[model samples]
Target: MKLQLRYLLVFAFLCFFSVSFAQRKKEIPQTTRLLFVLDASGSMNSAWEGDTRINIARQILSDMIDSIANVPYVEVAMRVYGHQYNFKQKNCQDSKLEVAFGSRNNNQIRTMLDGLQPKGTTPIAYSLEQATKDFPNDGKDTRNVIVMITDGIEACDGDPCAISRGLQQKGIFLKPFIVGMGIEPKYAKGFECMGRFFNAKSSRQFKGFLQEVVKQTLGKTTVTVELLDERNQPREANVHMAFIDQATDKARYNIVHFRDKGGKTDELDIDAIPTYDLIVYTTPPVLKKNVEIIGGRHNVIKVATPQGQLNIVQNGSLDYSTGHSAIVQKQGNHEILVNQQVNEPHNYLIGNYRVEVLTRPTTVFENVRVNQGKTTTLNVKRPGVVTILNKLSGYGSIYVVKSDGSEDWVMNLPEKGIPRTNFALQPGRYRFVFRSSEANDSSYSKSVFFNLSEGGAFTLDILRL
Candidate 1:
C-alpha cells in the first residue's frame, strides 16, 4: 500500500506542474521594443564638438544601452547604414539590421556600434524602411520605437519624412526620435517632419536627449479632453475626437468623447512623443491645432465647443413614412452640413443656419439661430395629398399657381399607361391639365384648379376628356 500511494502522489505532482506551466505560457507581459537606426555615412566622419560625429554618437549610445540592458519587458535592436561600402561607391541600399531585438542584446549592439565605420553615402529613408521589419511578432502587446541618429541630411536623395510618416500610419512604429548631430539650421528644417527633432550640439546634449526619450518611451502619459460650453464649463459629451499627428497629418487616436457621472471628462492615456492636432467632431468639426501633452502625467486640454440642440418637427403630424428630412447649412454658406430627419433632434455649434425642409414646395427658414444650452425648434406644415383619377392613361402637367398670377411647373404625369397618380404637396393652390389618350384633339384637354390644405386631401377627376 505504501508503494502504491507513492506512485499516486508522483502522478498528481506531474499533473499540477503541467497545468501551471500552461498558464505561465499564456500570460505575456507587454514589451517596449526600441530599434536604433544609426547613420554611419561619410558625413558622420566630419568633426562635431571636437570629436567625429560618429564617435560621439557611438560612445554615448553604447553607454546608454548598458544602462537600459537590465530593464524588464524591454528589448533593443540596432541597424546601421553606410558601414558596408566606401564613400566612392555611393551605395544607397547599404542599410542592414546589425543586432536584432532579443534578450540581453546590449553586448551585441555595443560591439556592433564600436566596429561601425562611416565610409558610404547616407541612406536615411532606406534605413528607416528596413528597420520596420526588426520587431518580432511575439503574440504579445508591444510598443515599437525608433531612434535615428544622423549627422547630415539624406545624401542618397531619399525622402525620410515621407517614409517615417508612412511607417507610423501603418502602426509599424511610434513617432521616431531624431537626434541631429550639429546639422546646419537650413538643413535641420528637413528633419522637422521626420519625428521629434532633437538637436544634439554636443555629446552631453546627446546623452541627455537619449535618457529623456527612453524614459518617455517606458512612462505612462495621459490626457483629459475637456470640451467647454459658452459658459466655459465642461458640459459637452458623446462626440468623437481625433488625435492627429501634426507632422504626418494622420489620425493616431480616434475616440468617442466620454464623461463620468460627475459630468467631468475622463482621462485618456496617449503617446507622449508626437505632437497632435485635436479635431472635435461637432456639427461643423472644430480644429484645435498643435496639441502637446506632458509625459509621465495627466494633462488637461480645454477647447470651447459651445453647442445647442436643433429639433425639426412637423406640426400636427408624425409620419416617418414620408422619409423626408431638412438640409441644414450655415447661413450664407451653400454647403450642406447635416441632413437632419424630421421629428429628430441634433446638436450643432451655436450659430445661425438655414433650414430647408424637403417637403413639396420646400419650406426654407433663414437666420435660424441656435443659442447656447437651448433648443431651436422648427415646425413645418404637414403635407396634403393630391390624387388624380382618370378614365384612361394620359399625358398631363401640374403647375403651382403663384399669388403673383405667374405659374410654375411642378410635375408631369406619365405619357400613357396608369390611370391614377398621387402627389404629396404642401398646402397651396395648383392647376392640373390632363388629356385622355382616347382624346382625338388637344382642344379636348380638361383643366382643373384646386386648393390643397394642410393635413387634408384633394382628388381631381377627368370625365373621359
Candidate 2:
C-alpha cells in the first residue's frame, strides 16, 4: 500500500509539470527579428569625427546588441556588402548574409564585424534585396525590422528607393531605419523615400540613433479611431475600422471600436509606422487618408461621419425600396449616395443631394439637404402615364414641347407593326410633336396639345396624322 501511494504521488506531480510547461509556452509572444544591413564599401573607410565610419558603426552595433541581450523573444542577424571584393574589381554583387537570425548570436555578429574591411563598391540596393530572403517566411505575427548603416548612397546603378518601396508593398518587411553615417546634407534628399533617414555626424549621435531605432522596432504603439457623430463627439462605437498601408493600400489592421470599462475607446497596438489610411465602415463609409502616427505617442483620429435618416415617401405611400428612389450628390462630379431599396429608414451622410423618384414623369427634388441626426423626409408627387396608340404605318419618335417651347425627347414609336409606346409625364400642359424617321422637314410632322394633371394611366389614340 505504501509503494502504491508513493507511485500515485509521482504521477500527479508529473501531470502538473506537463500542464504548466504547456501554459508557459503558450504565453510567450512572437519573436521580433531585426536585420542589420551594414555597408562595407570603400567610402566607409573615410574619417568621420575621429574614427572611420565603419569602425564607429561596428562599435555602436556591438554595444547595441549587448544592450538588448536581456530582451525576451528577440533575434538579430547581420549582412555585409563590399567587404569581400576590391574597389576596382567591379563586384557589384559582393553582399552576403554574415550571421543568420537567432537568439544569443551576438558573439558571432561581433566577430564577423571585426574581420570585415571596406573594399568594394557600395551595393545598398542589392544588399537590401538580399536581406529580404534572410528572414524566415513564418506567420505574420513576427515583426521583421531592418537597420541600414551606411555612409554613402548606392554606388551601383540600382534604385534603393524603388527596392525599399517594393519590399514594403510585398509585406516582406517594415520601413527600414537608415542610419546615415556622416552623409552630406545635399545628398540626404536622395534617400528620403528609402526609409527614415537619420543623419549621424558623430559617434555619440550614431550610437543614440541606433538605440532609438532598437527601441522603436521592438516596441508597439497605440492607435485610437475616434468615430465622431454629427456634433464631432466620440459618441459612436462598435463600428468596423481598417488601417491601410498608404504605399500599397493594403489593410494592415482591422478592429471594431468598443468602449472599455473606462468609457474610452479601446486602443490597438500596431507596428510603429509614419502614416496610415484610416477607413471607417460607416453608413456611407468614411476615409481619412494619410494619417500620420508618431512613435511612442497616442494617436487619435477624429473622423466626422455625421449621418441622417432618409425617409422617402411616394405619393401618399411610404416606399422603402431603394430601386424606386436615388439620392445623388451635387458636387464636382455627381455621385450616387443611396440607391438600394430599404424597407425601413436608412442613414446617409449629411450633405446636399438630388432626390430622384422613379414616378411617371420621374420627379426630381434638387438641392435636398440632409441634416445631422435628423430625418429628411421627401414627399414626391406621382406623374400620369400616357400611352400613345399609333395608327400610322411608319417609324417615328415623339417629343414633348413645354410652355417655353423647350422640347424634350420622349420615346421612339417603332414601325407600323408596333401599336404604341408609353410616356410618363408630370402635371403640366404640353404639345406632342411626331416626326417620321425618314422625314427631314418639321412641317411634314404632326403636332397636338395635351394636358395631364391626375396620377393615373391614360391612352391617346392617334387615328390619323
Candidate 3:
C-alpha cells in the first residue's frame, strides 16, 4: 500500500510541474537594455518651468535612472546630441555615447548628464542612425529599447521618419518611445510616424511620460498562441507560423506550433513591442493581421485556423510500383499549392480544392470540401495492369479513348522498345500505335486496341513480328 501511494505522489508531482512550467515558462534569465537618447540642442537652453530645458531634462532623467538602477536583468546606457559643438559651429553630426550599457552604472550616466550643455544643432536623424551600433551584436534573449527625449526637430537634411523606420525594420531595437518637450503641432506631426510618440508640454507631463515609458520597458513578456478550430477550441496544432511586425513591415519571428501531450500549446517569448501580423502555414495558409501583444503578461493571441486532412487512396490493388502524385489546387484557380503523394494524408486549411491525380489517365476531382477536424477521403478505383510484348525495337505511343471517339495522349513508348513492359492503367479503352524506328514513312505505323473491363484485371497485347 505504501509503495502504491508513493508512486501516485510522484506522478502527481510530475504532472503539476509540467503544467506549471508550461504556464509560467522556465525561469530562464532574460536581458533588456535601455538606451536613453537625450537631445542637447541649442534650443534646449531656453527657459522652461523657471529652469533651463537642459537642466530639467537632466534632473528628471537622473531620477528615472535611480528607479531603474536596481532592476535585475536590465542594463542602462546614455547618448547625447548637439553638446560637443556650439550653435555657431552649425554641426549637425554632433552625437556621442556618453555611457555605454553596463550594470550598476547609473552614476556614470547621471554625472555625464549634469555637465552637458545645449550648444549645437539638433541632428535627430543622424543621432538615431548612429544609435544602432550602440547595441551588442548577438543577443537572442535580449530586448533593446530606445527612449528619445527631444525639444527640436531635425536640423540636418536626414529624414528622421525614414531613419527610425529603417532601424525598426532591421529589428535593431523595439519601437522607440519618443517624447517631445513643448513641441508644436507642425513639429509633433513629423515625429508621429517615427515611433510611439508622446508630447510632454509641462515638466510634470514629461516626468509622467518618462515613468510610463519605464513601466513599459520593465517585465519579461511571453506569448501564448492558441490556434482555434471551427468550434472555437484550441484543438488545431502542428502548423508553422510567421510573426511579422506590421508597422515595420518586417518578419520578426517564425515558429512551428505544437501541442503538448496534455493538450497545451507551446509558449513563445518574443519582444512585446510590435503589433504582429500572424501567418499560419497551413495547406493554403491563413493570415491574421494586426495581432496585438501586451507587455509584462502572457499575451494570448487566438487565431481561428481550422484545418482538415486530405487523403487520396486507391481502393483495391496497391500498385505503388508507379509513383503517383496529385496536384492540389484551390477551386476557381489553377495555382498548385501542393503535389501530394497518393495514399498519404495531408492537412489543409478548411476550404474547397481541386485535386488531379497524376495517373496514366489523369483523374480530376473538383469542389472537394475539406472541413475542420475531419478527413475528406477521396478514393480512386484501383487500376488494371496492361502488358505489352514487342520482339523488335520500335517507337510507339498510348492514348485513352474518350466517349466521343477522341483520344488523349497518355505517354510515348521508349524509342528502343523492350521485349515486355507492364503499365498500371484505369479501367478504360486504350489504343497503342507503333512504328519501327527505322521506318521513315507514316504508312509503316501499326495499331492495336484493348480494353480493361475492371480493376485488378490483366490485359496483354503482342506486337506481331
Instruction: Name the weakest run of 10 consecutive residues (lDDT summed) in model 2.
Output: 316-325
Candidate 2, RMSD to the unseen true structure: 8.8
Model 1 spans with C-alpha error above 4 angstroms: 1-30, 41-55, 84-94, 114-121, 137-141, 169-171, 244-252, 273-277, 288-295, 316-321, 414-423
Question: TM-score of the candidate numbered 3?
Answer: 0.84
Give the per-residue lDDT digits (tens) of candidate 3, residues 310-400. Answer: 9998754355465678999999997999999888899998999999998768889999999988999998877887777876687888899
Off by over 4 Å in 2: 1-31, 46-51, 69-73, 88-90, 138-141, 227-241, 254-263, 280-287, 304-309, 315-322, 335-350, 382-465
Instruction: Please give, for residues 23-75, the per-residue lDDT of candidate 1 as tens digits.
Output: 99999767888998998888888887888888898899999899889989999
Residue pairs with backbone overlap in model 1? none
Superposed on all Cα atoms, model 3 deviates from the true structure by an RMSD in Å of: 5.1
Query: Per-residue alpha-carbon lDDT of model 2 for 229-287, expressed as tens digits?
Result: 77788767777889888767788888887877766888888767545888888656899
Backbone clash pairs for candidate 3 read none
Compute each candidate's TM-score over C-alphas: 0.82, 0.74, 0.84
User: TM-score of the candidate numbered 2?
Assistant: 0.74
How well does candidate 1 match the true structure in TM-score terms?
Answer: 0.82
- Model 3 per-residue lDDT at 119: 87
